[model samples]
Each structure stands twice: as structure tokens, then as C-alpha cells.
Target chain A: MITFMQISKRYGTIRAVDDVSLVVQPGELLALVGPNGAGKTTLLRLLLGLIAPSGGTASVAGYDVQHNGAAARRQLGYLPQRAVLYGNLSVAENLAFLAALHALPLQRVADVIALMQLDAVAQRPARTLSGGTAQRLGLAQALLADPPALVLDEPTVSLDPQSVASFKQLLRTLQGRGKTILLSSHILGDVQELADRVAILHAGRLIAIDSIPALAQRCSLPEQIHVVLAAVSGDEPELLARAGAEAHLDGDTLQVQVPLARKPAVIQALLHAGLPIRDLRSSSPSLEAIFMHLVGQAQH
Target chain B: MFRHTIIIARRELTEAVRSRWVLLCGGLFALLALALAFVGMRSVGLNGVAGFSRTAIALLNLVLYLVPLLALLLSISSMAAEREEGALEVLLAQPIARRTVVFGKWMGLAAALAIALCGGFGSAGLVIAVAGGDTSAGDYLLLVVRSFGLGLAFISLGLWLACSSSSRLRALTWGLLLWFSSVLLYDLLVVGATALFGGSALMTMLGLLLMANPVDLVRVAALIQLGGADSFGLTAQALIGFLRGLRGSALLVLALLAWIIVPLFGAVRAFGRRDFTA
Candidate 1:
């Protein structure tokens, strides 16, 4: 259980995180989405107790981040935006160092290395690894102690497609294991697939926090149905103007915004008026459109 | 805390021993000691080989300058590099106090320096004995112990600089500048100030200030080791007397403890409030 209440962080004149209040329930996967400088990193840091919040409180596993920082840290794992590990040490050595820090059993170090697929490069110096590999190593280090709550910011950003898929699968598995995960990413597709709920942040404010379906329902536009009439040509406008039919020509396709409840009546009127309907298609606003709408509204 | 310190110390010692520069420096010191020992044997004949004076002077001179330099090189950029690379944030996120991290790292680096100095001087002593050099066992032991004290002082000073800066280059520059000032310029200034004032109060202030500088304390102790403590000015004598009162293992431990404790405390305090994001 992660709780952030009335949190605000200021850097000089900029309010990096502004009056943000959020709760991540047990086993919940919360996705944080925002544009650049939208307080995603600051909020993560504040929750980790690495930086003090300008006001309010952040607690992890019932430990107040400010007053019981060590206790809170014991129950939390963090991956910073920039991972700077020891350059001279090998992957295994770095893992061992971190494991020693948390007083984890020695065997867990090897176990984490294998779980992160770092076995092949376990003996390699950290300085030699690529960006993606380094990021995975960072993740592996964070997971070594196996804390119940996780805050991963852009966990799959640097990974290849296969790696991203595997990582997403792993996240699903973790969710099933009852982990509270707060994953931050700019990509909506991942959020659409993985997140149980999402918190949209814009310019340091929490604009929306709800399930994708609910968010889509709230921000969704009205459905539009388009019926393309077969070529019975001129003077057909009067026929198409029958009751319950609101028709407009859009290139070759005739567009009609019909209530789903009134669809049968409109079709019956169109057929009775002798207007041949060549093809009919319904266009409903997708989650992408809803996200854009909400983000746009919040930006204002 | 002890476990953490030991874990850190082991890693630091392993890394320091594997460095090519440490090997090179150790080799050079051994060669220099061997050459000096051979010369001593030829000059003073057999009876002088058992005396404490030559070995004590050599160890004192070598440790006074080199230990601090090595300590500065090894540690001045340690925490700063970690900060630059963002590793400090990861480490701090663990269930450990910031001061614990600082102290553990300092202890680790200090352990490495102690080993390097003691090992280097021990090898030097072996070479001198092989060349039939004029140094008794008691004198050799004294020099080795003094080197440990000097090494502790330097390591602590390096840790102080490392904790203060966010950039390695800045830390290195500052560490070097301070080391140079404390070692070379501080005593000169004190002597000049005392001469200019010519009053007992001014003289005592100058005396206290000079004694406060670790390098001066080491230099005075070394002169005492070489039987010249009484030959200096009144202030220098007083400083040597103060150090001698704490002498043998007791004084050695105390001076080294002061060196280790003061800057270490400051480093820990500074680290507590540092913006680790840097």
C-alpha cells in the first residue's frame, strides 16, 4: 500500500509536483503518464524519501516517509531516472554489494541475476553494458530485496520489442503475485494493456485517476455511423432526409450520427425511402482519442 | 554498522591492491629504500646497522608526503564520482543512514591506505635488512607505526574533500590544493607570523596553529624520531613535546585517531544534508 497525501515539491520557482494526493492499493498496477517535466520523477523520488516533499506526507507500507524513512525504505525498492552503478565492478559484484546493503541472503543475489536474464553478462563490467542492459541491471538490483511495492519509471523505455514484451509479461506476473506497482511511461499502448488504473499528470497536477474503461467512457465522444449509399444518384437528398435520419455527405460516404437506440428506426426509414445503402460502418472514439482529450483538457 | 564497515573495507582493499599505480608506487618505494639501505651500510659500517635513526627518518619522510598523496588520489573523487554517476541515490535508497554510508566508505578507503603504507614500508625494511642497513627492530617498528598515523590523517582529509564536492575534478583540485597548503605553506606562514609579532601571546597562537596542521605534527614527530626535536625553535620544541607526551603506540594511536575522527565526523555531517541528486 503506497499513499501520497497533499504532496507538493518545489524547485526554485517551479512547482515540480503540486498538491498531488494518490493511493496505490495492494496489488494495484497504477500507470503514471505525462509529458516531459510533468513531475513523474519528482513524485517517485518523494515516495522513495530521497527528497523531502515541500508539504504533506508520503508513506509506504504504513511507514511515514519523513519520520520513519529507514523503515519505509526497507519495504520499498527504487530505480532512479539515471542509473549510475559502479563502473569497475562486474554485474554480479554490484548485485552482491546491493544485497549486502539490504542484508539479503547471499543466494538471492544469484537468483535475481538469473531472473533479470543477466546470467550471460554477469561477469562483465557495468561500464561495458549497453543502455538497455544497464537499465535491466538497475531493475534487477531494485528487485534483489523483493520488496512488496515497486515504483518503476519508464521501465521498458530503453528495451527492445522482445524485451518489452517479456518485461510486460513479467509485470503481469508480478501483478498476479499481488505487488503494488506504479509504472510511469509516456506510451499509452502499454498503459492500455498493462495498467489496472492510470493517473494522468499534466504540469505537476493529477488530472485523472481511473480505470481505462471508465476514463474512456467519461471522456469518450458520441459514436458516429456512416452509410454509403449505392449509386442511385441525384435528388436522393430528400429521400435521405426522412424521420430519424440526420444525413450529411462526406466525399462518397454519407455520415449520420445516430443514437445506438435509434439505429433500427433510421435504417428502416432509409430503406423505406428507396435509398440503397452500399456500405455501413460505425466509428466509435478509441481510448487514444479519450486520452488525448483528457490530456488536452488538463493541459489547459 | 561493523559488518557494513567490514564489507566495505574488504571491497575497497581488493580494488586498491589491484591498481597498477599502487603497484608502481610500492615498487618505487622499495627500490629507494634498498638503495638508501645499501648506502647506509657502506657509510657507517656494521655497528650503525642496528641503530634506529636512519630507518626512522626514511619511513617518516616517505610516509609524511606519500601517504597523504596516495590517500588523496584514492579517495578525493570516490563519493563525487558516485554522485556524478547517480549511484549515490541508489545506495542511499537502501535501509541505511547517509552517515553510515559515508563512514563505511571512509573506513574502507582508510583500510586500503593503511595496508598499502604498511606493506610498502615493510618491504622497504626487508630490502634495507638485505642490504645490511643500519636500523634496529624497535626503530623500524616506530617508523611503521608513524606511517599508519600519517596514512589515517590523509585518508580522512581525502574523505572530507570527497563528501564536500559534487564533481570529481573539483574535489581533486581542492584536495590537492589543501594538501599542498597544509604540508608546505602552513608551517612557513606560522613561523613568519611568529617572527613578525615577536610577543609571547602571538608566538603561542602561531604555535597552536602550526600544531593543528597534521603535516606539521608529522614533521615535528619525525624530527624527534631523528633526535633533532630539541634543536628547533621554542615553538617547534613545544609542539614536539606535546606529540611525544602522546608517543609510542599511545601517542601514535591518538594522533592517528584525531586524524581519522575529525574529518570523518565532518564528512558524515556534510553528507547528511547533501543533495544526493547531484
Candidate 2:
């Protein structure tokens, strides 16, 4: 488990992380999302004990980050946004160095190397690696110790879609093994798919934190229902309106919007209206939209 | 702590070897040693190769000029580049103390420099011995060891500068200015100060100033040990009796050691206190 209790990091008058308090329970994946200067990296650094918090405390696996930093760090694995590893060392050498640092056996290096599918270019210098290969090496290093908790900041940024998929699969595997992960990213789709909880930070403060469904419900955001019809019916608009939905018709297809709770009633109404409905599709407000709505509110 | 430090140091040593830093510095030291020997021999009406004493004295000046600068640049560049390139942050995030990182770098770089100096001098010595350049190996080894000591002292200073500076460019700039001050500016300042003060005040100030720089400390030690004290300046010559004894030799050794330890301690403190954010 990882916990931050009222952590604050100040630089002169600017507060980078302002009185933030949160926890990632064991076997939970918490996604931290924010704008450019939203303190995501600062909070990660504070947790790693790379920088002391201006106030409060951070702990990893019950060890205080400040007082028991080495022990705390031993329980944690970190993958920075752009993990510029040792450029002169080969891929295997870089992994081996980190492995030696954590006192792990040499077999662990080969394991992570194979886990990340980095066997082909293990002997190549890190500086010559492609973006995807280098980031994989970074992940390999992070996984070398097989720590109980992992903190990955923008790990998938700048990666190709295939690599991102590969990375997420590996993360899923680790998650399955009960690793507590705090992932920071701008990619809300991944967070929506993977996170047990999403923490939205803005202007150095967490404006919102909850599961996507809970957040959407709390915000009372609308969901879209795309209705495909076999033939245009003049009464379709009136029927949707009568069913208390805000809808528009283009040809035989009707696009409808309603409160998430009202979705079932709209579908029932459409079926009962005797219209030749070819298909019906519903999309809830995306995490991105929820983020924007919340951040916009916080901004105001 | 020892394991972590050793691991880091070993990696640093590997980097040095792979980057050809060891070879580069080694080759430079060897070429310069031979070149100085040849130059010293021709400076007189003599040719072939100079004697051990003559070559040792010439090499002492070379050590002061080259070793410190190389050590400073090598160490500062390594530390600052790690910071800029995000290696330090990743390494620090591991379960290691900040001092371990600093000390590891120091030890590893120290070993690399020692190997370079040894290889350089050993190869040059082999060449010299085969050609009947000089018969005495003791003086040659002493010069090599002193040059390594000088390099260590400057390496510590460079690590301190790297830790204290906010950026790589700033660190490099500071390292260069420090090298300039240590090598050229300090001596000129002392001379100007001596001329301005003149008399008893100048004598004490000059004596203190001689001990203040590692370069000058090694220089005075070289002058005394190589029997050039009487032939050198009166200021240094005045200390002939005091510095020539066993106690003075021990004091000078301790002083050189202080040059290594003090700055290294500063580096550890600075690194621990500062943020390793990229």
C-alpha cells in the first residue's frame, strides 16, 4: 500500500502539491490525471523520497518515506515519464546494474528482459535504442526488484500504439499478481479501462477522485443513445420527446441524450413506439469529458 | 551500503573503460611523460633520455597542469551529465543513500584515474627502461602516485561543484573557472599580493598560500623530496628545514587527504539536501 497524508511541496510562493491526501490500497490501481503543472510528478518524487515534502508525510508499504527512505524505496518501483537511462551501458548492462543495486539475482535480469521482450537488442547500447525499446528497458529496470508497489508516470507517452498495448498487457499481468500501482497519465481512455479509481488534479489540488461511474453519477452527466431505424418515421422525434429525451434525427437514425438513469426508460419507449429500430447504441460521458467538466469547474 | 556503493562504483568504472576515458587519459599521460622526458633531455646539451630526477621534476609540473584539469573535467562532466540526462534521479530512487551515490562516483572515478595514470606511466616507463632512459624506478613511481593523489583531490572538488550547481552547464562553467583559479589565477594572485604587501606579512601569507592549493602543496613536496628546494624560490626555500623532515611529510600527506575528504563530504551533504528532479 502507498499513502500520502496531507503532503505539500512548496517552491517559494508556489505550491507544487498542495495539501494532497490519498491512498492506494493493496492490489489497487490508482490513476493520477492532471494538466501540465498538476503536481503529478512532484507527488511521485515526494513518494520516492527524491525530494522532501514541505509538509506532511508519504509512506510505502508502511515505512515513512522521509525517516525510512531506503526501506520505503525498497518496496517501490518507479518509472519516470521519460526514463533516460544510462546511455553508455547496453540494455542488459543497464538492467543488470539496477538488479545489482536492489541485490536481486542475475536471473531476475533475464526474466524482466524476456518479460519486456527485449532479448533481441540486449547487447545494444541504450543510446542507440528506439523510443519503444528504451521505454521497455525502463520498464524492465522498474520490474527488476519485483517490488510490491509501482509508480509509473506517463509511461506510455510517446510510445506507439502497439507498444502501449504491450505495456498495458504487462501492467495487467503485474496487477493480476496484486501489485499496487499509481499510474499518472494524460490518456484517460487507459485510466477509464484500468483504474480502480481516478484522481484528477488541477492547479496543484485534487479536485476530484472516484471511480468513473461514481464520478459520472455524481456529476449527473448525460449519456448518448444512437438509434438506427429501418425507415424514417415522422413520429420518432415526437416519441423521443414524449419519452423525455433530447434527441435529433438524421435520415432514419435518431441521436438521443438523457440522464444516465433515464437510459432504460428511453430504450423502452423507443421499443414500445413500434418504430423499426435496426440498432441502438449508448455511450456514456467519457472520462475525458468528465475531467474537462470537473477541471473547468475547479478553474472557475 | 557497501554493496550498493561497490555496485555503483563498478558500473562507473565500466562506463569509464567503455567510453575510452581510461584509455584517453592514459594515452595522454603516457605521451606527455615521454614528450617531457625528450624535451627535458634536449633542453640541456644532452640527448636520448633524461635521468629520473630531471624527468620527475618535469613530470611534476605536467601533473599540476594536466591531472587536476582532467580530473575536474572528467568528474564534473560525469556528475552533471547524469543529472541532465536523468540517470541520477533513477539511481537515487533505488534503495541507496545519497552519500553512497556520491562516494561511489568518487571511488569509481578515483579507480579509473588511478588505472589511467598507472597504465600511462607504466607504458612510458617500459619504453624508457628498454631504451636505457633511467635506472631509478622509485622516483618514477613516486611521481605517478603523487599525480594520482592530485587527480583524486580535484575529482572530489569536481563532484562537490556538480552537486552544488543547479544545472549541467552551470556545473561545467564553475568547474572550468575553478580549474583556472587553481592552476593560474591563484599563483598570480599570490605573487601580486606578495609584491603589494612586502616583508614579514608577505612571508607568512606566502607560506599559508603555499599550503592552500593542492597544486602548490604537491609542488612544494616535490621540490623538497626531489632536492630542488635550494634551487627554487627563496619563499619556498625558506621552508626547507621545516618541510624536509618526516613530520612535514606526514602533514603534507594529511593535507592532501583533507583536500579529498572535505569536498567529498560537501558533495554528499549537498546531494542529500537537494532535489533530484529533472
Residue-wise C-alpha lDDT for candidate 1, range A182-272, written one tens digit per residue:
8888877888889999898888999899987677667745456787876646555455555555667776677776655566777677667
lDDT, candidate 2, at B71: 96
The lDDT leader among the candidates is: 2
Candidate 2 residue lDDT tens string, A1-300: 899999999999999999999999999999999999999999999999989999999999899999999999999888987675798999999998998887788898998888889999999999999888888888887888988999998999979999888888888989999999999999888888889999999978989899898999888999989889899857777788988899989877898989988888988998888888889888888999899999999999
Give lDDT per model, in order: 0.75, 0.88
Where is model 2 more than 4 Å wrong at Cα?
A250-252, B197-200, B233-235
Error of 1 at B149 (Å): 2.3
Worst 10 residues of 2 chain A by lDDT: A76-85
Supply the global lDDT for candidate 1.
0.75
Q: Which residues of candidate 1, in runs, are more than 4 Å off?
A: A82-84, A220-295, B18-25, B35-52, B55-59, B133-135, B238-243, B246-256
Chain B TM per candidate, please?
Answer: 0.84, 0.95
TM-score of chain A of each: 0.81, 0.96
